[model samples]
Target: MEISFTPEIRRAGLAGAGARLLGVAAVLVSLLLLLAAGPPAAADTTQVRALLHQGQDLLRAGQNDAARPLLLQARTLAQKVHFEAGEIEALRVLGKAELVHGSFAEARAFLTQGVALARRTPGQPGLADVLLALGQVANEQDDYPGALRACEEALRLYHDQGKLRDEARTRNGLGIIYSSRGDFPRALAMLLPALHQTQQLRDSALQANCLTNLGGVYFRNNDARKALYYFGQALPLVRRQPDQGALADCLTNLAVAHQQLGEFRQAEPFYQQAIAVSERAGEQAQLGVVLSDYAQLLTDLKRLPAAQTTLERARALLEKSGDVGTLAATLVALGHLHQQLGHGAEAETQAHRALALATPIKDWSVQESAGGLLASLRKRRGDYKEALRYTELAQAAHDTLFTQSKAEEMGRLQGDYQLSQERERAQALARTGERQQQRLQAQQRQLWGLGLGLAAAALAGLALWRLNRLLGRKNQQIERQRAELTELNATKDRLFSIIGHDLRGPLHSLHAFVELLAGPPLPPDKLAHYTQRLTHTLDHTLALLENLLHWAALQMGAAGPPRPENLDLAALANENIGLLTAAAEAAQVSLAHSLTGEEQAWADPAAVRLVLRNLLANAIKFTPAGGTVQVSARRTGAVWQLAVADTGRGLPAPTPLQELRPETLPRRAGEGGQARSTGLGLQLSRDAAARNGGQLLVASAGPGQGTTFTLKVPVAETVEVPV
Candidate 1:
């Protein structure tokens, strides 16, 4: 049960795991040494076999880009000669090369063709080899569950074929996949016999894969020291048989491990080596995943702009390869970079895009990174409830990754495997001479394997228990949210009640004023007063209805998709000022704006207009005759702060941003003899601000002091709108 752990290259280029910079590679697998076979034709099967062997050897030597031509040639020759097995072998090996190089779509194409050919051929289940290649491809693509099934079936077939070599390779594939999925117990269980089995074989490829994958488990478990130990052990072996781009990916694994250990000087060379190797091999995954990881090291070195360029290059490379798993990680890295650069909206877009491509290829690191960033962004914008949900998502990923107890258990599992391997070694030595020692040592190996097996079984139970507890907690959280929703519905009913009562007066006044105007032939002054009153009531009712409808639409989630744009704040404010000038004049309030003309925001222009109109109208209404309502704006990091300050009867107290919640009643900006407002305007403004990726903040000194309502919206750095 001697397990050489492969460096599970955790994708740290993703935002999750606090940038530990990668677990080892899931798809940096052993290229299968497939045996070629076919009926003799004009072109001898032997020549085809030789070509396949040479190409596969080059593949094993870490030259996939170099090997692909040869493999393609073999497939062509086999196809011409009607040798299905040879064609299938070539296709399978080609798929293997592509899969290891992080070209999943191409890999699947090749593997699917191999499967089709194998199914049509009349022979032993050639499907096993093809299935193994498909499984490896699937695993690298982040379709772990699918991969596990494919590999398990391949494992059964390999056993039936009595191919211990193939079986060990399949099992090792299973181990790496299990490790990728955060299933340490199952990973160890698979790796134990696979590593033990490989030790008896003369295959450096399988042995290197075993050790490298075992290292991956340690990396996932967060035991960087132990992870480094296994990675260090596996690298030379990986170098010996650098299948596809395993050597480059292995270099990345070493870099991250060293990076995690704070050995940047040591980490840098490995990262450069990985870049060089991946460049030489022209493998996108290594260049994409590993180079992005190397960018993080640059960030650590305080080379921010260079890191940005490096990350962009990695992202561009991945975008072309159709490796969504790697692409998602790259997006996560880009989001993190945006976060560092104070581009909140851009960062959010990147994270959401990463989250949006939800396929079976579930990279927890991508989920973790995306979730963590989203949570932070939500919190920054004062949406604690949404933040909490994202925080829970991040926490779930973090907890599943590894706990101290889980790590301790894995350590024990490793010790058990190590002990059995030593016992087997002892048994081998004893068998050379001492029969008594051999018998005792043989018993030790069995005992060690059995004991570790039992421990792994116990861990399975523990995992189930933990999962159930997590599920129960999740259920409780769901139930709690349901209750909150119920409360929100009730609160909405109350808000409707209030809106209805407020609308009642305006409507009744409008009806009575219209009737009086229609029926009465009164004195000139009286008729004029009635006409003015009727018009005033109509305007008030229309304004109330508009605000009420806007509120209702937002609450009902029927507002449709946002139509955000890069809006010039100064122009928009000027337009609003022109629209509100008559009202300002009627109220004898002087309206002024201090927009420097360069202020701009990224927001829905329509929504922003409503928000600004509401705030300004509220200010004008609250201000006494001869008072001033002034509009001003300033840039604040990644947002624009537009403030409407009014000389009026101020708020009773300072209103906190948290008080802007829907559940909280809006505090009137002022309360004086000047005018009475229903307070819906402020609420409408607040809601509109929130919808536009902004918030309306209220500040006031107690009664009669001026109030300032500042609307915060995302800054428009360019014409490009965020998704």
Candidate 2:
């Protein structure tokens, strides 16, 4: 039995075969056109046109590396041939090749030159192409404003020439730019129409491009389901083409969408496919992007070793490709990988390197990512203060990007809708009465209807009026607050000035006495006796004045103590002992010093001396004849416990230990039974010790059994500083 193939089945089979044949023909034609063109002739203008066709063919074949050299050669030959239109085409192709290779600087140079040449050569078909190429370059460089301007110009030129295919391409380009800038709504509007236009023209390749761009928009808008749907639709068309560049792009995008949806199993395969295609095509820069993205995915999946290897490979590829932007991103990804693997220092180094690259490029996204990683590393090292500062910087960068994106999106939408409104108004005037009424009725129910617009305007005006009144009151309140703050600051400054001046007098007098006593103008015995007495009084007076100043500073919110430094506590104790010796002898108190263990502690030396002196002086003042005052220190497991034990009248009643407030420390009565405190010596001592990461504790065995004031200071390894 001979089976007859029906016309319908034959037709279907032929259609499918024809599509595959066309794709193969396109690839073969591209290669042949490039080879046949050869080098342009110096005086042959026709050769320039042939070279342009060759460049276009190479571009269609996704051979950017081959295309770039050919296009560049064409541009040079066109210059020699004085074929300005041909030169513009060559430049446009070169720009596109550079953009695909991630050479944004070179792309900009070529595109700018193309734009100038196109303008000079009036009525050239290449002008719109050049503009579109420039727009694509700008979009890749993240220059959204420049991209939008170029796309709009290209669209206008294409529309004027009735080039609907070119117009659709420009619309798709605009959609990609808007989507990147996070204008999803406008991106959708531009891309959906472009998709429809391509589909209507039955151009599978252009349709795939539009679908890919639309998927990107949906992904950016966080509609992963829609994004995946569009991406899937584009894939079959992309796979049918011999180039497969769009297929790789769609696969990568689908991977991202799946990753966003937490479908890592599905995403991983797509990423691998994209990477494999990029590698086979010898697209090093695109390969690096896929690898870096995959590395990030691996890091998220806790595959540290694989992520590290992938990021390193991407870095190597990016370095060779000279794409600093993607290289910086790879470095940031590596930094995160290191951070995840518990390598804080390595993470910091990588993040800093990324930041260094990103800052010069002014790529805010990379800069922000690097900065955030660095800040997190610092926080992990227990540097919250520095982390906070870096966090603020990252936040500012994010805010700037967000605000600019929002403004650009709003501006584009308003411009497009406003133009549509004007067109509708003009058409309404040109219509018949019945048609005009029908149009008005239809528009009344539309979202951007005239009635709704008028109502919105009225509400906006009312809101603005109320906002102005509220702002006026808020401004007045701010002014009053500022004035009050200024007055309060002035008062604080005056208080500090008074305390400084008052304390300086006594300090200067004491210094003068010490200077005179140090000179050789008096008898040795007389000098010794006089100096001993003067030193005792000076020490007391200095202590009193120092405490008063510190207390005043604290009250004024300016009590910032110097950081702790390594010092010998034994030496400080001996110095204060010498200063208080005469007073101890006069009071009949036996003062002794002892060191039980090698005690090294971190503390402010001046503060420690003052504390020791105050306790010693108080013991001397209150002790009876032959009473003993002992100063001793011992090491207690990472702490240096320094104790000032005294056999003196310690308490009048039940004493508050842990409940003691800072204000009560310097209020003890002297040997003269005076209730008044000369200064805040004890309070300042407590504050200084606390600042150095330790605390002061006072303990006693009831009334007259004696008291021991122990300062538990933290011990640290000595750090040397140059004088």
Candidate 3:
């Protein structure tokens, strides 16, 4: 059975295919015409035309200062002669020159005036050019949406006029606008076609611009080799033209591409050439950027001295020119350079300044760089906690940049996929046109299924990408926790070792004294001596055990808040002196006590008792035979100061009070060589005092000179007692 092919179905398929074909064909034709379009006609007067030409020539050569006066004269003369077209052209040139010199307001004023004049004139010939200049001004000011609007309008004008060359240039401008927004794929799509059209027209200057823009897109996309290839192709073309500014930019890009690839040796000469060209043309802004980049290259090459000099030069130029964008970058490079030179303070200063400058501008690249440098500087200075903070900030910035880059990549891929889908849709329509009516339905169904499948695949891919990112973050967190656990385990083992080492001597002495007491009774004199010795030994052992318990409580985070109460500083001092009096007499050390007034203290009573007992015992033990130990208390404003002074064997040298840890304290024999120390008592005392809102300070003048221990605590308020 032969199936009839309905005309209605055929027409439907043909119409759909034809519409898509027409749209594609129209875009291609428009691009071709733009490539062939000639330059705009000359101004009305010979003098106006000459002035405009000279100004444009000078502007192309990066001599904006020299070109401004000529353009101004042309504008004035054209206005005087009532030459609207000439005035428009002169205004356009002046606006561009002003824009290049960092005068956005003046450029906008001139360009807006030119646009207004072109509208009032009969033909409005210069309107598109004025709009294009305004778009560039918007781009320079970082107004992306404004730039896009202006460029699109100019593109429409050029398309309507069949001005292919102007359209090509506008397309390149659109690419640059997209690039500034970090949309690299969109940028490349606009730039590549423009480059092809410019090459076809054999416009050397335009072609060079297109090549440079393509290189920039590739550079931003991290395609360094392709960027290098395009930059190399543009270098000779820019040199051949009269555009010194373009040549300088080309040279700098080449140097950057090489430097990124670790080809520093090959990059140096290009940087030098770029710097020389910018300097000769008096392009201070461009010179500063080039010098800053060169300094970065020098810093990477370990040529620190040269990098510093170059950075200083760049800083001076950028500051004078008010180029904050480049200045921020220069400062980041300077910070890194200072870090490499071991000037930590200078590095930190520069990094902070860079962050401050870049933050207001929202220059994320500069901010990220400065944060990284600051992190490194902090780490080098041993400020690890603060270094970690900067590191996290830098990482966040890096992730943001990476996400932006990935989005651009996705946009490019999506654009390509959409183009392919359009082609397929057209092809399916063509096939439908050839098929019978019965098969047409089947083809339609097949096409719908294919589109749905493609969409589903795209969604799945995006979902998988997101899932992978989440897993990566989770893995990073797990790794960090694992490292922390490892460190904690090491600390636990060290603590156990210290506890065993400290407790061994005291335990052994206590065991020996217990065994002696349990043995047979002795004569009266011998028994008295044994009893006294055993008492001292038992006290020393008990003190050591208490210190260890306190330390363990502190380590375990079980030392709860201190219980503070009011107490007489003098009474506490006398109590401790009496407690240590027996030991002092046994050592043949004289004990003395003195107090003035009430000398009340608001402190944890237990902590104060431990502190006093430790200090008095240490003084008595360290004192030689016939040495005197003096305990005194006094009131100083709203604070109580207690001093424990001894004519004892002092510390061998000056030791920092802050560094008086248990491990650092000296273990020495007493006067009779019967008493030995564990060195934990002083550290424990200090820790206890600190917990009670008090401080223990030690002063010593070397061996054989007396040492004094001063304890300071807040005074308690006066309270009424029973009459």
Candidate 4:
């Protein structure tokens, strides 16, 4: 009924007392072997054997209270006589009784004691039994890693002794552990082989155990029909055995499988049968587990009231039984039932109860379900923060469980690989036996075959070495190209970033432009010198931004054709000269403009302003202290010419600085020292001038002589004013 593997269920099935009638059989074997060896009568070991038999009988009958004192007495008497076998058996049976009652800690203590004694006695075959019991105890407590270690060791022992049936039984136990961890593939791999072994051994009880656990794997994997088939097969076989606990488990699993398949009508009878078995055994804890699962089926039927009632009964039974894991699970089931009843607040309270219990025990399945339900409840009430918090908690629990399952699967893969190799070796020996007479002739051919194989291997190695060397050289070339591309991309990004950096001075004062256009302009010499200088700086900066922005848009094809107009070159030159005044003063350079009223050009206003600003900014930035920057404009033939000349480090052979690149670092100047690159601004201005049906020209005598940039635009056409 508890989907997780329980020691109570595992011990009641394939292993422990279920493997054989250890009571009379073990006592008879001990007596016969001792009699044949002619020893042990001096210590009254026969009386100790009698006590162990009596205790084991009561234990197998599920009478724990009656068996405990007898098992204790047997242990005491056997220890006094130093009858180690009888003492160890008594300890194992005592642990079995405790385990049957769900007292895992006490059971583990007893089983550990038994294992230590069995190990001290050399060649003790009973060690495997103790280890299997301890493994079950560890699993019930959710110590999966510890359980794996114990079960695997016991498996190795069983296989070494050629005890095929016991090995199969251990495999069944391991299958259930994997299934409980929600690892279905490995669980099936482990179960199928054990199921086949049980068939060969004709063990009805073990076959039932394997079928039930295999069905559990299928159920958890959502293959309900296959689960139902295996569970149905197990039920009748379990019924043939005297163990009511095993029968109850089989019945509960059958019901769960049927419920999973949506066969509620078929599931009800099995749940009732399991409940009846539990009541007969007087196990309130086991009864609680069945009732909890039964409520799930009821909830599916939309019988909410009935489900609530069932869960209430289960909660009371589980609380008294002190089964933490099942009790926590029952609380979550009750919470869901409460939700279906429309009692939202009550449902939350039940979920919290389950969470409190599950957290301390690290019962991740219970914690996850409880947390998920609480998250939904909070979300319904619009408490999104709390909902998110609980959702994270549930996910963490799920990931932890998943990680543990994956790690176990990896370990199982390695073990399976070794197991396959061992099987292959066995087959090879059998084949060698069948071909014994041909050994001499086979040896002669094998020698020649070995020579040919070595020659082939040497040739292949030589080819592989040459191929590796070629690949290495190719990889080096690829790395070099990749590095070059990376550098180019970085340089392009830096260039764009520089443009944006230059735009910020104007963009920051952009609000001033909006306010000035909406209000009044400053009168000449009215504001303070610093404020006056800032005003002049903002004026030309606005001009620079307009043209720069428009030029960029046109180059990207984001805007239509440029708007040509009769722009006044004299006015534009005076405005740029005013804008560069503050920058020229900061650079210790004098600036002036010479423009006549007759100068005018038919070109895009924004494009012309951008070319003028780029040339003027370059002049101010590069000009040395006490140097002069002059802006002049005139009409040359049918076009207007605007030129900015600066007394500073002149231009290189125009090609080098005109190109845009980050590594176009500053060249050493004559008197100004190393000057920063004029950079992509000039290139941008040149391209914009071409797009506007004009050109930008540059001239310099040499580095010490200074450079001059001239802009040419078409002369405007005029119509005669004849009235």
Identify the candidate with maximal lDDT: 3
TM-score of 3: 0.41
- TM-scores of the candidates are 0.36, 0.43, 0.41, 0.44
Cα RMSD (Å) between model 3 and the true structure? 24.5
Ranking by lDDT: 3, 4, 1, 2
Q: Which prediction has the highest TM-score against the true structure?
A: 4
Tens digits of per-residue lDDT, candidate 1, 224-338, equal 8888887887888888774648888788888999999899999999899889888899887668888789888998988888998998898889888887887887788889888
Off by over 4 Å in 1: 1-162, 242-244, 301-306, 315-723
Clashes of each: 24, 0, 3, 0
lDDT of 3 by residue, 252-332 (tens): 999999999999999999999999999999989899999989988988888899999999999999999998988988998
TM-score of 2: 0.43
For candidate 4, what is the TM-score? 0.44
- Ten contiguous residues with the weakest lDDT in model 3: 1-10
